[model samples]
Target chain A: AQSVTQPDARVTVSEGASLQLRCKYSYSGTPYLFWYVQYPRQGLQLLLKYYSGDPVVQGVNGFEAEFSKSNSSFHLRKASVHWSDSAVYFCVLSALTNSAGNKLTFGIGTRVLVRP
Target chain B: GPKVLQIPSHQIIDMGQMVTLNCDPVSNHLYFYWYKQILGQQMEFLVNFYNGKVMEKSKLFKDQFSVERPDGSYFTLKIQPTALEDSAVYFCASSLYGGTYAEQFFGPGTRLTVL
Candidate 1:
């Protein structure tokens, strides 16, 4: 069975400050990791995904994530955040198997608040 | 960018009432999926459909739940005998099937409140 864990439930950062949201996953095979963002009353939007190769992947809105296989972690980071960055971020892991139907196991999610 | 549209952005219903949520996926996408998220909870996968059949479903998908993509049109999730625990935001997503890489496009979501 595969699962994802997000350490922080909520995080607050001042505008223009750096941000990092932690995410860890438990999976046997090559894990396809992804980051998604959801604003209030809005659908989730994919930020970035990492399957293989480059451990660091860049995403929209100046977002990026680093995949560390040894640590079993993929943390999202942004050099500077804006008030618009206030939203819920989710880390998801998917196994590369035919039986799984590419179903994603998502972390509980971390709510980010950017205050001015 | 492609989009998935969900109808009835929010619905309030009494317990035990039957409710059907609708989703209009991207015009050419062949894969559709459903996910549920309660207040302050993770978004969990409920089911995935392709080629007019359910390819996968999670434990949360009970017998009372059904999914259909009849006439190759809109996809729908029908829950019979809704309970208080069923109150959550239901999201519909679509993706290109049999592709080299799959990226799902999610709908804004439908908030269902069962009182």
Candidate 2:
């Protein structure tokens, strides 16, 4: 079984400030990680995904995440956030096996508020 | 980017009644999925369908829950004798393939309120 943990339930950052959201996963084997964001009344949109190779992956809207194998973490970061960046972000985990069928296990999600 | 569409953005139904949630996935996608999210909780996977069969289902998929995509039409999730606990936002997602790297596009979600 795979699971994800987002320690921060909420985060408040001023617009144009740097933002980082922490995510940790519990999985023994190599895992495929993803960051998804949900705007108000909208469906989740993919921020980025990590499978292998480079630890740092860039996503849309100037968002990026670094995958740390030793720390078992994949944290999302943005150098500058806009007011529209206020949304709920989820960290998801998927096992490498086909038997799991790529079903995603999600964290409790971190709600970010970008104050102007 | 491809888009998935879900019908009935919001639905209100009485407990013990039957309800069906509809999803129209990306035109060429081969896999469809359903997930549930209660108020202030993480979204959990319910089931995945492909090739006219259920590929995977989580324990959260209750016995009363059923899914089907007839003749490549809308992928539907039907629940019989709905309970209050079943009241939640159901999201429909679809992917071009079923694998580790497939990206699943999601619909805006259907919010079901059972009273």
Candidate 3:
């Protein structure tokens, strides 16, 4: 079984400041990782995804995440955040199951508040 | 980017009643999925459907729950004799394929309130 953990339940950052959200996963095999953001009252939008290749993957809106196999972590970061960036971010893990399709396990989500 | 649409952003039903949540996946997507999230909790996968059959379901998918996509129409999740515990936001998602790396696009989610 695969699981995801987001240690930070909430994060507060001033607008134009750097932001980072921590994520950890528990999976023995190769893991597919994803970062998604949910704006107020909106559906989740993919920030980025990482399966292989470069450890650092850039996402939309200047967001990027680095995968660390040694640390079992995939943390999201943004150099400068806008007020609109305030949203709930989720770290998800996907792995092949015994069934036909893959199932996604989500972290508890970290709610970010970008204060101006 | 493709978009998935979920019908009735919010639904209120009485306990023991039946509720059906509808989802219109991406036009060319081949896989559909349903996930549930209670208030202040992580989203949990409920089931996935492909080729008009349920490909997989999690333990959270209760016996009272059922899913279908008839003639490529709306993918529906029907829960019979709904309990208070079934009250939660149900999100519908679709992907072009079914694999470890397939990206699933999600709908805004249908909030079901069982009283």
- Model 1: pairs clashing at backbone N, Cα or C within 3 Å: none
Q: Is candidate 1 or candidate 3 better by DockQ?
A: 3
Which 10 consecutive residues of model 1 chain A have the lowest summed lDDT? A94-103
RMSD of each: 1.6, 1.2, 0.9
Q: In candidate 3, what fraction of native interface contacts survive? A: 0.74
Query: Among these predicted structures, which one has the highest DockQ?
Result: 3
| Candidate 2 docking classification | medium
Against the reference, the lDDT scores of all candidates come to: 0.90, 0.92, 0.94
DockQ of 3: 0.78
Estimate the lDDT of model 3: 0.94
Cα lDDT tens digits, model 1, A1-116, are: 88999999999999999999999999887788999998887788899999889999999999999999999999999999999999999998876546324687889999999999
Q: Which of the numbered candidates is closest to the native, going by highest TM-score?
A: 3
Model 2 stretches astray by more than 4 angstroms: A97-101
Q: Residue B107 deviation, candidate 1, in Å? A: 1.0
> What does the lDDT come to for candidate 1?
0.90
Local accuracy of candidate 3 as per-residue lDDT tens digits, A2-75: 88999999999999999999999999999999999998777889999999999999999999999999999999
Error of 1 at B58 (Å): 1.0
Please tell me what DockQ candidate 1 reaches. 0.52
Score chain A of each prediction against the true chain A by TM-score and list the results: 0.96, 0.95, 0.97
Candidate 2: C-alpha lDDT: 0.92
Worst 10 residues of 2 chain A by lDDT: A94-103
